[model samples]
Target: MVVRTFGISVLVTIASLVVAFIYGSWEAVALCAILGVLEVSLSFDNAVINATVLEKMSEFWQKMFLTVGIIIAVFGMRLLFPLVVVWVTAGLNPVQAFDLALNPPAEGSGQESYEQILTDAHPQIAAFGGMFLFMLFLNFILAERETKWLSWFEKPLATIGKLDQLAVIIAGLSLTLVAEFLADDQHRATIMIAGVLGMITYIAVDGLGSLFHTEQLEEDHERDVASRAAGGPSTLVKATGKAAFFLFLYLEVLDASFSFDGVIGAFAITADPIIIALGLGFIGAMFVRSITVYLVRQGTLSDYRYLEHGAHWAIGALSVILFISIEYHINEIITGLVGVAFIGAAFLSSVVANRREERSDGDSTPKSGGGESPSEMATATD
Candidate 1:
């Protein structure tokens, strides 16, 4: 797995650099490398989080993840998603937007100016951020209640399967409508709509998954219902495959959550559609792949027990920040930094406690005799 991941990364790096060079070397190269490191660092926890879901998947799905999923992430989501968002927000044709993003007023000032203009022109990113946070909050709560408890009381919670995809689609349309209808009215309503829409989307998708899910392709409700036959419990029974699909949707939402800040931040850096696409796109996809690889290879979810917990907490915090950005913008640096700090503190505490326990144990060894050794007795007495 490690070797394969590394090989994939190398191939991607080469291909991305080729694109970057075709665009021009300096900014693209620098941006790619920087975003590479930044993404790698920011998404380390994402890999571990994904592993928990990925392990349960069938080999075919896993293979699809490595092949088709990466393409969606790299070409579709990472590259095109931003440009599409920018085009929609800026109200420019793709050609103009691409050109504007690619070529700005000054050489050194290309990045900053473009970002400022994008921010000024669009103003909907705040909506995306806010919406992402709200969706995540719902997701985490639903995930928590359902996973940690299986009682009948929690049965209603199982219906939460609908919220993941709902968030993004709602966020997209809400922002689009806000940019359109409520241009100057109650600005906050946009956030509310986005939030509610995201929630509904999640519910719709996951609920459908639960209601119509099946392990066998032919046994599914889509098939059985089409045949006009009442299928048994096995027809709608949720398998890890369905869960994996939702989990993939959940991860995409999470990626969008992280990218919401980074996307907006791209304006802060450079808005060259090609630059953004080639640079941030490369880095983001690479990091996502690297993260998935790390989790699979290192088995961090198994090894670093608290890493997943920490990241989910960070995701939860980020979710709040996203919602709050509707009224009070949260800086991305602060968001990532605070998350790192919280997790770092937790990690350090774990390490320190581990070392202290090890030391105490070392000093409390039993002697050959049935009675405790002097050191052991002294340590015990102390």
Candidate 2:
């Protein structure tokens, strides 16, 4: 199972490194390797979140995610998206933007390089990606769930979630405050517009998925009831057709939100778009996708219980970091470490919880001649 999951990523990593070496020299190879590791470290939470959504998708869509989705992620987000951002922000034509990326302005030339242009556009990017991720985190925490990892915090939030569009209200206020205080006069309006657009994008994509998913649930329930009456085995109701399409779209947008930081952060390592695409797009993305599949196939999220919670909380922290990054330069190392800390802490908590449950079950079990009580045995079996 491990090899089946990671074989492609391994092959791609080797190919990417070879390409990097051929493209430049051993220095390029080293930089590519470093960037690949950086992307994987920064995106572990992204893998966890992707697993939650991918597990619901049909096999065909899952295949598409690994195939067509990878293409989009590699070229579209890693390569073309940065070019497009440079074009829009710097008022350059397509050829000019592409040329600028390929032939960056020399340092001390008093001209803006591709990296500088992208960095200058950070306010807008931060506002957009930050709000999108913030909405995702808000929706996850605000929804009432059977399992709560941080009950002390999540319980009160869930209670307040009874108010309609409370997430939107809070997000709106947060965006307003950031725009007012963090953004300067020149970019204030841009940040506000971008943030609102981010909110709208999240609502549209997530709302469509929920609408179709609710219908799918009703249909599955009917099918399950009919199957039970006929005494046949019931099958899992995975999302397919239009429902899967929307979910796939949602996943891509989510990936884009996650990639915004990685793409920008890559400039700190290298200005070459080719290297970034090879390292981040090919190598990092493949492994992240593999990890997502492995988690789904292994039922890691179900077994750990709080793994998903940790991922979402990490996302919440990343969103805040993005907003903070607009005004201050945040080191990528800090962002990566914060996510790892959350996931590690949650994994430890899950281990402790599992042991406690086991002990409780052992204590409640019948001993000696009593054997096992039928009800207790049934509960244990479940």
Candidate 3:
């Protein structure tokens, strides 16, 4: 199962290495390898979060994530998004932007133009992606729910969530505050506009998902009563078709949010867009998808409860980092390590919880040595 899941990743890695070798020398290949590792490490939390949503989706959508979704992640986000950023920031044609990326300015020119263009656009990118991610975290932590990993924080937020659209309010205020941090008037306006767009995108996608929801709808009011009368909790049935489409959209956006950092950080390693796409887009993206699928098939989320919570928390941290990075440059290595630390802590907590449950179950079992139930003693004697 593991090999089957990761087969494409292995192929992608090999193909990227070969492409990198052709692109330049062993040095290029090594850079590709480093970028690939960086991408996978930085996005491990993304895989975990993707699995949390993907598990709720139907099998067909799951397959689509590997096929159609991979194309978007690799080509759309990794390759084309950078060019688009350059184009928008530099006010250059797509061809010119692509050329600039392929052949950067000389080293002694203080900094590479391609990198500088991307850096110039960082404020807008951070505002957009950070707002989107911040909303995701707000929704998760604020939504009214009984299952909570971080009780003190989540409980209060859930209580606040009782007020309708409070997450949006908090998120909007957050964007305004962050925007104020930008000293340049143009940069501040850009952040505000981008932040609003980010919030709008989230609301639009969420509304679309609700609009398309049909599986839980009742044909007759009588049926709902009967369903409620049953002792079991009512199941929220989602229509396979509409639900999958919305889920696919959500997954794509989620992937894009994760890729924003990678796209910018790739410039730090190499100015060549093709190599960046080959390394982070092809190989790294494939590995993340593979991990998502593996987690779903193996029921890893069920086994390690709180993993999703950890991933979301990691996302929240990343979102904060993204916002801070607009004014201050934070190292990609630091970002990656922070995510790993959160995930590792969550994993350890899960392990401890599992052990506690095992001990409780063991203690609850009827023992023959003590005054046990007659049935247990009979079974033991038999």
Candidate 4:
């Protein structure tokens, strides 16, 4: 699988180069390379979190991730979703909006085209990213801890929640409303609030699952045992339903988080819808699928719990940064770099933690571990 993935990566690089050179759009190639690398680096925490959560999924669901999940990432987010955002935010009919995108009016002239409007409103995007950053921080910091809380209300608050899918839908709608009511200059805060609400909704559901009164796991040894015990071929039938649902939802959201940066970055490269849709669609979907596969087969995440936490935190940070850029008018490159830095720090911390554990054990090996090996981990799920 590793070799195959590497080969695909090489092929993609070559293909990107060929396409860029052929179209005489050396810029596209550079942008492709930049965006591709940015997605991977900034998304490491995403990969770890994805792998850890995906471990619970059934094979069919994992397959769905590679298929349906990709459609959401490459094509949906970069291509269709943005158009939807444009139409809803700007209140232009689809035909007119797309026409604007296709033939963006000249810069500084304030043309009628959607692309021109978007370009004219480009500072609005950065401002959105900035507000997104602060909103994310609020959700992470003020939203209360999910694992264990200091107060009693936390548990009741958690257990009363419904499906996480609802949260995504609501957040999407909230963004639409924000785009509707808020002016370009003032929308960053609105974007941030929407993002925070989205996260709060996700945690509300997942936290409810965690609050289900499972047996407490106290030690690494116990966790390792539970991890090993989770692996019965017989369990595959039951595991599929739970695992697939989580994996699908996870992939969908992760793709959205990833595209927040990619879509914005793509605008910097070129606003051509065809180019954006085609290039981003194929590339984003492909990499996300590849990432899902790596997590499934390798089981690397089973040994690295903190890594997933780091990724989520990084994602949380990126989301906030994106929201903030909406109003602050910061550069897109800086936003990407900040996210990349967060992921990088988390990754380095993971590597260090892994090495420290290895040294402590006098062996650079991780004993297979997870929540499934014992009744405790399984109970944690239930």
- Give the local distance difference test score of model 1: 0.58
Per-candidate count of clashing residue pairs (backbone under 3 Å): 11, 0, 0, 39
TM-score of predicted model 2?
Answer: 0.95
Per-residue accuracy of model 1 over 172-241 as CA lDDT, tens digit each = 5655554454445555555545555655554565555444333444454566576555543333322346
What TM-score, to 2 decimals, does candidate 3 have? Answer: 0.90
Predictions in order: lDDT? 0.58, 0.93, 0.85, 0.56
Candidate 2, pairs of clashing residues: none
Candidate 4: segments with Cα more than 4 A from true spot: 9-25, 107-110, 119-239, 362-382
lDDT at residue 183 of model 1 (Cα atoms): 47
lDDT of 3 by residue, 1-382 (tens): 9888898799889988998999887988988898889899899999999998888777778888889999999899988898898888778888999888887878897744877888889999988999899999888888877567778888887887989988899998889889886536879998999889988887888678666654434432345567789764565553467766887898899889888888888888887888898889888899989989998899999999988889989999999999998888899999999999988888888899899999999899866667888697789889
* Candidate 1 vs 2: which has more lDDT: 2
lDDT of 2 at 157: 95
TM-score of 4: 0.64
Model 1: CA > 4 A from native: 1-3, 103-124, 134-186, 205-243, 327-330, 349-382
Q: Rank the candidates by TM-score, best first.
A: 2, 3, 1, 4
> Among these predicted structures, which one has the highest lDDT?
2
lDDT of 2: 0.93
Candidate 2 per-residue lDDT over residues 212-325, each given as its tens digit: 988988898899989989998887989988888899999999999999999999999999999999999999999999999999999999999999999999999999999999
Q: Which 10 successive residues of model 4 have the least lDDT summed?
A: 211-220
TM-score of model 1 vs. true structure: 0.67
